[model samples]
Every structure is written in C-alpha cells, then in structure tokens.
Target: WSPYKLLTVFTFIFQTASKDGEVRLVGGQSSHEGRVEIYYGGQWGTVCDDNWDISDAKVVCRSLGYSDAVTVLLKAAYGAGSGPIMMDEVACTGNEASLMFCRSNGWRRNDCHHSEDAGVICKPNEDESGSEVEGTTHVLDRSMDFAESLKNLYETRQFCDFNISVKTNGKESETSIICTHRIILLLNVDANFMVKDGAENFTLTVDEECTPYVDDFIRYLYIKKISVTLKSSKCIHKLASMYGILELQEFCSQLFTQLLPEDLSFQNQLSLYSYALSTQDTMLADSCLQYLAWNCKAFAESEAWYQLTWDQLGNFLFRSDIVVPDEFFLLEALESWILKKGPNSPDLDKALIQMIRFPMMHPEQLFQLQFNFTLYKSHQDLFQMKTLEALEFHTVGFQNLNQYVDLSNIDYMPRIYTSPTWSYLLSGSSIYNQYNPYYRYDYQNFYSQLRSYSSSFHTPKHTSFLFQSDMIQWSFAYYESAQSCRNSGRYCYYDNYPVLLLSFESRPSSNYSIQYQNKALMICKDSYVSDIRDFKNNLVVLPSNDTSSYTFPCSSNFSYQYVVRPLYYSEFQNTQ
Candidate 1:
C-alpha cells in the first residue's frame, strides 16, 4: 500500500479500536501495522470501514501499547478477512481508551462486506530488533536501571576510592564527608580536581549559604536526577556550575523557567531574571523577559516594578512586544520607575527615557508627556528634541513619512498596544507555481480588529495577527496568478500578477466601537523585497459609518508578499 494509505489506516485503527478488546494485526509487513482484528465474545472478526478515520485508528494503536497511529486504511487494503464483520460505523473521538468504548453499530450487525474491512498502520516500535510475540511474557531485570544501581553502590560504599570533605565554615558535621568513586567524580561531576598520585583524600570547600545544595549536587552525579525546589534552584544551579555539571546547570535553568512564572510572584520573576542574566542563561533569561513583557501592565503595578533599577526598566522599555493598554501607560510606568530611582542626573534619566518609542504614542499622550511629566517639565530643553521628533512622525502624512523621517529607527516601529490605537501586524504569503501552464490560486487569511480586548488577556498578542472574536467578520484575500503562460506553449512573457482584497463587516448591535479618531494608518510592506521595517506603501482607512468596511486598490507586482499593519489612532495623528 502507498504511504498515505498506510498512514490513514494507522489513524483509523487507533481511533476506532477498544482497549478492552483483544486486538491484533493480521496481514501487515511488520507487527506494528496490518489488517485490524478484534476478538469479541470468543470469536475473532474484522471491523467494517464505515466512517473509519484517523481518530478511530489512534485508539486501536494506543490500545495495543503502541505510541501512536500513522494512518487509517479502508476498503480492505490488507485483503479481505474471514469471520463476521463484527463492528460497523465505529465512531471514536480519539481520546477513547479502546474501540469497545466508542459509539458503534451493535456487534455482528454490520451492513458491510468482507472487502470493506478497516485497517491501520501504527507507529513502529523504536526498538526494531523484533516485535515481541503475543501470549509471551518476560521478566525484567532490576540491574537494567543503571542510575539506581549506581546509587545503590554509592549508598553501600562498596568501592569508594575517594573521600570528599565538604567545608561549610564552622558548620561542618560528620555527614559532610561523602565517600564516592574517583573516576565518576573526575568524569561526570568535576574534571578539575587534581589527583595527587596515590592520595585518596579530597576536600572541597563551599560557603555555608551553599551547603544545603551540596548534598543534592553530589547525589545527582550518581542518580542523574536533580532535586531542586524554587527557593533552592538558583543555589543548586550555582553549585552545579561550580562542580562543572553542565547538564545539571541546564536542568536548573529549565526548572526556573517553568516554576518562576507559575508558582512565585513577579518579584521572583525579576529576581530570577537577574540571576539568569548573571549566570548567562540566555534561555531562562529570555523566558523571564517574555513573561514580563506579556504582563508589563501588571508587572508595572507590582512593587518589583518600582524597585527595578534604571537598567532593568530600560531593558523592558526597549522590547517591542511589551503589552500595555497604550503608550501612555508605558509613560506612566516610566514616571513611577524614575520617581523610585530618586533624584538622578538629567542626562542619565533622559538617556533611559529615550528608549520609549514616542512615535508610537498618541499626539495627546506626547503633549501630556512633554508638559505634565515632572522629568520633562524640569528638563524641557533635554526632552524638546524627543517631543519634536514624535510630533513630526505623527503629523507627517503616512505617505510622506519615508521622505520626512528615518523610518528604519526603532521609534517608528509600533509596539503591541492593547488599545485600538494599533492592530496586530497582519501577514500572509503567496508563492509562484510553475507546474501548471495556466495557474491562479486564491489565498484567504482571516484577522479581527481590537485584539488586546480578547478574553485571553494574559496571552501575548504580539505575534498573533488573527484577533480572537466572533462578533465581527474580518478577512483579507489575495490571488496569485501565472496567467502569462496561458497554456501558450510555456514560452510566454513572465511577470508578477497579484491582487489584494480586504474586508471588514461588523455584526449588527455589535458592542465594539472604535475609540479616538476613526482614521487608521494602514501601512503595507512587501516582505519579498524588504524587512518588516521597510514599507512598500501606506493607506489611510476610514471605515464608513453604515458598514464599517474599507478596501485597498491592488498594487501590482507586490501584493502577494504583503505584511500589513493597521495602526489605530496612536500610530498616526490627524495632522490636517
């Protein structure tokens, strides 16, 4: 059978079979795949392929102790079987443990012929030495657990060739001396330990604060398992690094990423983030930053935000994915951070404040920030240039932005503002197909407005273009055309032909309304030619009062490579 057919068979059986039923593969080339047969009521019978699918196949495969089903097969792909077609129209939801639990026609009451038998191909066992035969059992050997066996040796002190004396200042006890293998320590734990010819004694010294983590670190070398709690993960990670156990260090990093966000408060997040940075754990640090950025609004209100150092606050403001109601919220958060920093030099304060993307802020926000903020008020001369730069970006018509301002700067890029001031960046792509002589393919991608107000509040919307909502219908479609060939002997003229259509229709009585100015800065970028920062063109969208809909005229040769962002009132002000 073809690979596709085999895969279909696997899925159908896994989803269709029952755990309580005795199932077996009859005609597969390997034990993991074949015609499915189930023993029901003291007789074996084949299943009918009525509504058989991948989900049905999954249950069958998993019931047989296989990992998963590769595909579902139908119409007796493995050849017709004898005996009754016991179960027909078997419907499995894939989560069912066995085919016996699935909804199906009464057993032995199928309206199917033997040729309509259902089959499946399951994911083969990773160990392909040979499939274990049915009706056979083998005893497992306890010595196979190498880590446990090694641990047993360590506990028994059967072959101790080295003694490690841990010193915790004046806190050392008899338990501080650990007997271990010299080669295991030299190979896995720490390779830097200098072995003095025949000297069997070794003394390792660590601060009292890290003494608690030493036992776990030493035990991990024998068992290959780390026992670290939230409070001790950092110390254990440090101990592991000191002992040259890179695997343990990585384990602690991942543990921190998982625990810091869920169990502890934002203070722990900040503390762990700082520790991760100090330890140069980029993965852990990045995870912490993402958590903070996604919850910037909440984090800003926490005591940790007020306690953040100037550098830490700058680190957050520099990120383009910081989630907040608007740039004004960011300004307020920065004001609080600055006030907490106490009195500082105007130059130093201004340098940190420069990280804000003022261009993304509303004109009103910029005006208030310029005149009302204490820092801006006290040092107007220092911030005057920033205020003017933002004002220019807002007032410059969307069409004139490239000519008047440096669009490549970070300030020009929009952050993920929850307010309707900006829509999530919309993306879709199309590729040229040369297989067919005359080809035209239509690609439709859906996206909604006002993404920040979705019910899934804490989830980050920076990377999502499709706003989660059912009240409003929002979508964009583009057609990729290779009509130049037109089946005219394949030597026709070649050119890029593409068209874009954008639509938005809100349901009647929809509670959604556009706040602030109705006009939006619809910036378009052709990703084929430039990065997201480089704009191919721009459009001013003013949804009509009756329909709340708008469309853009096709820009030839580049519509297929579109990455459009509709900046709400905040992106560009009414310069007129």
Candidate 2:
C-alpha cells in the first residue's frame, strides 16, 4: 500500500482499538450534555447520528464517567460541529467499556454532514436513588485513568517533535516559543501543519498592537475558551481575523451585536462606533449614534466629535431624529466644526450651513446668531438670508406661509424638542370613536398646563379660543367630524368621513400687526409625532394669550408638541 493509505489504515485501527483515545462533550449548557465528539487522527470530530440511540449514548456516557444516559439527543441538539464527521452508524449493546470499543462504519468514512452530528445528555451522579455503585465507580476510575494518561503525555512531551515560535515586533521585540507536539499543531492550529516532510520548526510574526491578546488566542487553542470584554473584543477579534479563525471572529461579531451604548464609557463608545463603521457593523454603529443624539451636549464637547470628518459631521447634522435639550446646541456644534475647518471651501461650507434648522431655533437663539455669532458675521449675506427666512416663519404662522413657501422643506419641520417651552400631548387609542356604526359623543380630553401656556386640549367638541400673541390677538376654532360632500356657496367639499377643520381670524390690538418691533413673536407647532411624519400638517399654532387654549383633532394614537419662545428682531441691519 502507499504511505497515505497505510497512514489512514493505522489511524482507523488506533481510533477503534487504542485505550488512550479521548472523548469529550462540547458546546453544551453544562459539562454532561453536548455534541458527542472523539479525539482521534490527531484531531477532534463529530459522530454521525445514523441509527444512534440510547444504547450508543450509554457507552458514550460510561466513557465520560456519567451515571447513565438520560436521553439520546440527535441532530446536534447543542450545536452543529464544524470539524470532520468521523464516526457513523455506531451500534452499542449497552455493555461496551467505551464508545471506541463499539462497532461503527469506521473513522472518517461517514456519508454525513455536520448537520447530522449527534449529541447526548447524561444523568448526573447526584441522582442516586437506586443506581449501580460499583459499576459507576469502575467507570469513574477508568475515566480518571484516561485523564491521567493524557496529563502525563502532555507533561512528558511524548511524540512531540515540532518547535513553533511567535514574535511581535516593537523597539524590544517579545517572542513566545512553544515546543509543540505535531498532532497538537495539526489539530488545533490550522491545516497547514499537515506536511509530508515535517519541518522541525515554524515561526509566526504578529502585529505589535495585538501582542497582549496573542497569548489569549494561543490559550484558546488548548482550553477552547477566551475572555472577551469591550476593551479586549477589538484586539482579540483582530487577532482572530489575522489568523483566519472564522469561529472566533463569529463569536466576536455576536458580542458586538449584543452591546448597548451604556455598556461602555463615552470614549469607548466613540472608539467602538468608529471601529463598527470601519468593520461595517451597522447594529453597533446605530446604537452609538442613538446615544450621541440624546446626549448632544455631551458629544459636542467631546474630542472625538471635533475629530469627525466634514462628511461625518454633515451626515450627523442631516439626521432629523436628533433630539437635544435645545436646538441651539446643534448650531453651536456646527459653528465649532466650521471654525476648525478654516475658510478654504465656501461652497462646501454653504452646503453644510443649509442643514441647520434655523426655524427650529428659539427666537432669542436666532437673534444671538444674527448679531453676536462670529461665523454669521464672517458669512453675513448667507446667514442674513437664512435669518430673514426664520424671521418670516415666526412672523407669519405656518398656515399662512403655506401659500408662499413649500411647507415640505425640511427646515420647516421640527425635531422632537424636549425643552421647557415645548409641551407634549398624546391622545389615547381608546379615545377615538370615528366612523363606527354605534358612534357616540364619547370623548377623552388631554389637558397640559405650563407656565407660558395655560392648556393644550384634544377633544371632539368644536371650541373657539380668543388669545393674544405677545404682539397681537387672534381667534381660532378647530374640530373633527364625519362629513359628506356639500356646497357652501364659496367652495365644495368632496372628501368623505373623518375630517379636521379649522377657521382663523386675526383681531389685532393695534392697526399695525406687521410692524417689526424689537421683539418678534410666533406660535410654533414644534413637532407632531405619529407613525407618519405627515401628521405635522395638522399642527395648529395658538398665539400666546393670558389663558392660551389649543385644541387637537381627537384621533387615535397621536402625539404632538408646541412651544412658544420669545422672538427678538433687532431694529438695526448690518450693512454687508
């Protein structure tokens, strides 16, 4: 026979007859149950579940020193194996000393995949209500003998003939040298070790950054476990990727997927976010972005925030989901980024400046930007136009601006504002009785009273309110009802049931409501939150009155916020 065929035959015989062959459970919840695998042919491999039963499980459990087979688990109950399917159609008579002694299709001769890998759950010795004491003791003794033999073999370096050295480069390079057995290297390391003319020694070079984690990687080859924390996950994953350890890389990916932003410090969060972007780990990157969005003030001062590229900064600002204590912080952060970038590209700067939601800023905030802000002074013409648009949005209510401006503009939309000036109101799902056969006049009211505003209400009843803006007084009424097509002299309505209607009238205290005083005033429907962002069109901005009252259409499961901020418009205009 050829040398390769002879070697295969010798391996088959040794695996079937050698008393020194080892067995272990892997990927189990506990030690007593998992996929059944045997150590032979200088490697570990799974057993096929063909014709596998409790009798076969008994022999496997006896070999492992377990009391008895609790049950035979088939089709890889614990987890699928990744190695070769070594044994198949194992038949045990429940009297064999070991699974090795049982009949099988033969080693490495199975027509099976890892999906068919077998598993077992063995009864613990603690359950001894009525058990065989002497037989169990004998099995335990044999297991101890096998363990002792392996320990002795490992310590004495028996059959070991290869030397492997791992080194990391630095100013003073550190090296780890191992006198390894040929079988250990071939089984644990990689398939490259399976050589015809066995080289006496092998050397591997590692990156200096991965030096600390290299030992842990080496230990995993022997113990099959490694410690991973947020701090070490990156390094260990890097080492695993470098060595093409796909299983270890998969484990690290799972760890990253389960991570939350609060699981790491802010600095570590930023570092991991950058790492996730580089590695294309979208889940982890999104979690970090959520944390950053909520903690806008904290991220604004962070060194990492300053280090973001212009594209990164622009993308972050473009997100409409960013919720801060106030929108002014966003403007300030952008200003800081602009100053850091210098005055090289005015076109790029203009593109980024348009991302600012100037209409969302408080009136006082806009006043400060138009006058006191240095960036605004540097680009007076651009900011002056933006400031004028925001001023128009404040002076003319959104409903009035619908004729002149495209309300679909993102600048006209409001993010979730959680400041004191903004008030949130949610209508319960149970409150609406719309388009129901047995519809009644039943309604639920949500009333929110704040310092600047008295009450915001959601009710089906048609209610009119007479309120004064800090500048002028206005009267408005809004209600929801089921209506059919009708002609009312001026216009015809064709839409059917469930419509919200509003009527507005301006009653100015003075003849000149449009006169620009030192202070500008407008009521903003800050945000309308529903499954769809289109709910924003329903926002009814009620001017500030002594007893300000605002009403919403009584629809199920909807929320909105409105804020009234002090608007300041200066009398002096800076000459460009």
Candidate 3:
C-alpha cells in the first residue's frame, strides 16, 4: 500500500510539472484560441499547418497550462501571420514542451502561404477559462481594483466567451459567474469537477453561500446600474467584494466573534452558522456551536430553540455544560419544553431523545418516572448520558447550599453584593460579566496569604463589607440599603439552593487582628434579624499562637490562617 501511494504521488508531480510550461498565441478573439506561436532563439514565429492536428494542438494547449485542446484549425483561422514561419510539419506525441522540441522542419522552412497559419482553440482551465492573461495572476490590489476588474472582464467576455452560469440544488440558488481581472484561479484539476458533464459551456454548481444572484450579479457587474436598490446594492457589494472566495473565511469568522451580542444575535447566528458551515468556514461553525453551548439552558427555554432542527437541538443535549443539576432534572426540562410544542408536535428526534441517562437514574426513581412518563428508544445515547452524568456528579460536582452554609433568613436571602474600594491590589473597579473581569477571588489562595504574624488595620467604622483584605474589593449592601441594588430581584438570591457556603470570597481591609466580623450587626445591632448573631457575629476566627495555618471548628474543609499571639502568653505578659 505504501509503495503504491508513493508511486501515485510521484506520477502526479510529474504530470503537474509536464503541464506547467510557457507558450502563447496571437491574433485571435481570445487568449485561449489563436494562431500558434513558439518562442525560440529569442525570436517568436508561427507553426506551419503542413501536419497541424489535435495531437499537435494537445501539446500546444498543455504547454500553455490548459487542460486540453478542443480543436485545431487551418488556413490562418485567426487571420494570416507575417514575418517568420518558424516551423513546418511539426510532430508531437502530445508530451513535448515546445513545438520547436517536436520533430519540425527547420525555422522559416515552411513551403506554404501565410494563410495556413495553423490556429487552435483550447479548452478552458475551469476557473482559469475567462481570466485575461495578466488578470489570471496579478489583478487589482483592493476595492478600487475590484470594481475596475469587473468592468474589464465584462467588456472582454464577448471576445473570450467567459460568462458562466451557476445553480445550486434548491430554489432561488441560481446565479451567474463572471471572470474579472481579480479572478485569480488556483490551477488544479479538482476545480474542474464543478463543471457539469457534457455541457456545451461551463455550468458550475457550488455551495449555497457562493451561488450568485443571476440577474442582480450580471446587471450590477456586467452592465453598470445607474441606481440600484439599497438591498440590491448591499448584495452586489458583498458578491463583488470577493464573493465566494475562500481567502477571507478566517477574517469573517473573527468578525462574527467580535460582533456577537453587539452587532449579531441568536436570530442571525443560526443563519450565519448554516451559511458558514455550508461554505466550509470551519472556524465560524465551531465558534457558533461553542457560543450556543455556553447559553444552552436559556436557549433551550427560549422560543428560538424550538424553531431549530433536530440536529441542532442534539448538539446542545450532548454538551457537558448544559445547566442542570442532574440527568433527571435535564430530562424534566426537556419534557416540559417538548410539551409546550403542543399535541401535534413533530416526531421527536429518536437519536437525541435516547441520549437521556434513563438507566443511570436511581432504580426507584427510574421506575417512578417510567410509570408516569413515556420512554423513547434511547439505548446508546441515554447510556452515555448516564455514565457521563454519574462521573460528573461524583468528581467535580457542586452541591447546593442546603448541605453546607445555612441561609435561614426568611426576609433576606444571601445578598452577595460588591462595593467600590480604594486599594493597591488592582486598579479600577467594575462589575463582572465573567468575560474578563479584573476582580478575582479564590478562597484557598486568599487563605494562604494570611500568617500568624500578619495583621491589617482594623476599620469597623468602614461599615459592613462583603470581603476584607489589604482592601475591600466587594462588600454586601445592608438590608436597609437593598433598594439601591441595580436589579433587586437578580441579587435577591431567592432561588433556594446552596453550594459550599463556608466558602467566602471577598477583599477589603485595614485590620490588625482580623476576624469574620459582621459590620451590618455592628451598625444595626437592634435590627430584627432572627438568630441575628448566627448570620453575623458567631463566625469569628481565633488564631493559634504558634501554628501558622488553622482549620475552622465547624468543618475540616475550611482552612484559614490568622495573626494572633498565644492566649497563655498574652495573659502572662499582662500580669508582668
């Protein structure tokens, strides 16, 4: 297998080199067909027609880097040539580089009139068919050149027969392709596969993103429209702005990434994703799918999600980050969403429906659900979801606050608020949407910074703070000041779920011997907060005199370090 593959590769390279050579034609309607000319000894001369045929034309076309020759002509088909009749009776097995290299009568030895100039027409090189000579390689550099190139191509089309029509499989997908000066065709045999078989002229069918608007494209590009519709003009601009070209695909992908939630929305994201994926814009499709995954929960509940195809919905179901407590919770959400689709809802995608971790459900819970709800045939996907969910639940799963920190307040839920602070940690204060917020807090890392001798200036007068460090980066609002919250409902934290409550992430301080002091209680010591001390003061820390690291008495999970002298030492020193 290896040997065969290597031989095939070597053959291809040989063929490519054989075809890519220099040759030219003169005095014809277009570059593809004319009286054949060969340059040798630094002088140009015409081929004699004594033995001109398609075989010789094949050699000529291949030399000029065309795919093949369509026909050979006699009697100066592109009009008679003058000066030197370079060669006569040329013979080629269709592999030689130049006519001069082929068996030919010596230069200027043709015994024929200039009328027998031996012209030939070559087959179009797929994308290269309509491009003018220099235009095929080096065209305009930018927008100004794009417009000018289109005009030049339109004018030259009559001479080259370069106009082409393209159609796609669906309705409203037909369009024309016009070669312009900027239409630099990357030379390859695969590019020719788009041409329909047995077609008299080039008929190409490409992906939907590239299908031109036949009328609009030709009218705007071929014939200059004096005034076009704004919509039409925009379409024209997009098409002519290097439309259907793969070169700018990455640029477009990056553009969409920056524009999202600003210039783009979920409504347009779907369309763009489809278009980009169809056009082979890989980065764009990947980015779009990732964005969808991040907002999977909200999107699933939104009207937009129901509008999506089954395949699209399946993408979300497979994501590990879909916001759900467990497979059972996720299944319930899916069922509810499906119910909203009404009794006449289309058939559920069986493949996706089966992905629910049904078997993994606790045996008792699964049996209860089975009695109450319908079960689909999800043998594999459902199993996969079960295993994945179970693995996730055991390892890195977070349990809500019920098991840990007690938020027993009836009127006030855990209102984690942030207040502006003047500190040397980081400059500028801002709320986080989590894209790239400047403020960061980690419980373990914050604990590491504290030591037995460490101390911060005490500032109880600074009032209640959510966090305290070298500076207070975030602090909760007092109950009386709750009305000032940007969104009271959002910060209410009323959805009664808790996760690792012992974890407190905060910054802000000037304290000598720090403790979990409740400033709210200090300011409003008379407020009616039930078991108020539990919500505030009883959470103070007592540091060990000799130990540098300490653990909270409530749970071993909580680690802390405090700066304090030994209790016995403090009393003895006081006595002395």
Number of the top TM-score candidate: 1
Which of candidates 1 and 3 is the stronger one according to TM-score?
1
| TM-score of each candidate structure, all chains considered together | 0.50, 0.41, 0.32
Misplaced by over 4 Å in model 3 are: 1-159, 166-200, 204-245, 248-265, 272-282, 321-329, 341-576
Report the lDDT tens digits of candidate 3 across residue range 354-445. Answer: 55644224344554553554433323445445444434322331223223322222111111111112111110111111123122246656
lDDT (0 to 1) per candidate: 0.58, 0.54, 0.42
Ranking by lDDT: 1, 2, 3
Question: Against the correct fold, how does model 2 do in TM-score?
Answer: 0.41
Q: In terms of lDDT, which candidate is stronger, 2 or 3?
A: 2
lDDT of 1 by residue, 1-576 (tens): 332332243332112233226788888877788888987766788988979999989999998889899999998999989865667779888977577666564455444667888999998777643555555344343332455556766777766777878887675663367787766565552433534465677676776777877777777776666568877888888776665566567667656645544522488888878877887777567767766775677788878888677677777778865666776788788877888879988777887778877766666677676567887877677568887887776555544555556555667666656554343333332223322333234465533121101010112112112222223333333222333223322232222222223334332242221211111222223311111111211211111121101111112222222222334223334311
Q: Model 2, stretches more than 4 Å misplaced? A: 1-165, 171-174, 177-205, 218-224, 241-265, 274-284, 302-304, 340-344, 362-364, 385-413, 423-576
Clash count for each candidate, listed in order shown: 36, 0, 21
Candidates 1 and 3, the one with greater lDDT: 1
What ranking of all candidate models by TM-score puts the best one first? 1, 2, 3
The sequence of per-residue lDDT tens digits that candidate 2 reaches over residues 450-534 is 1111123221110001112233322211123222112112232312112222221333343221221110111122222211111
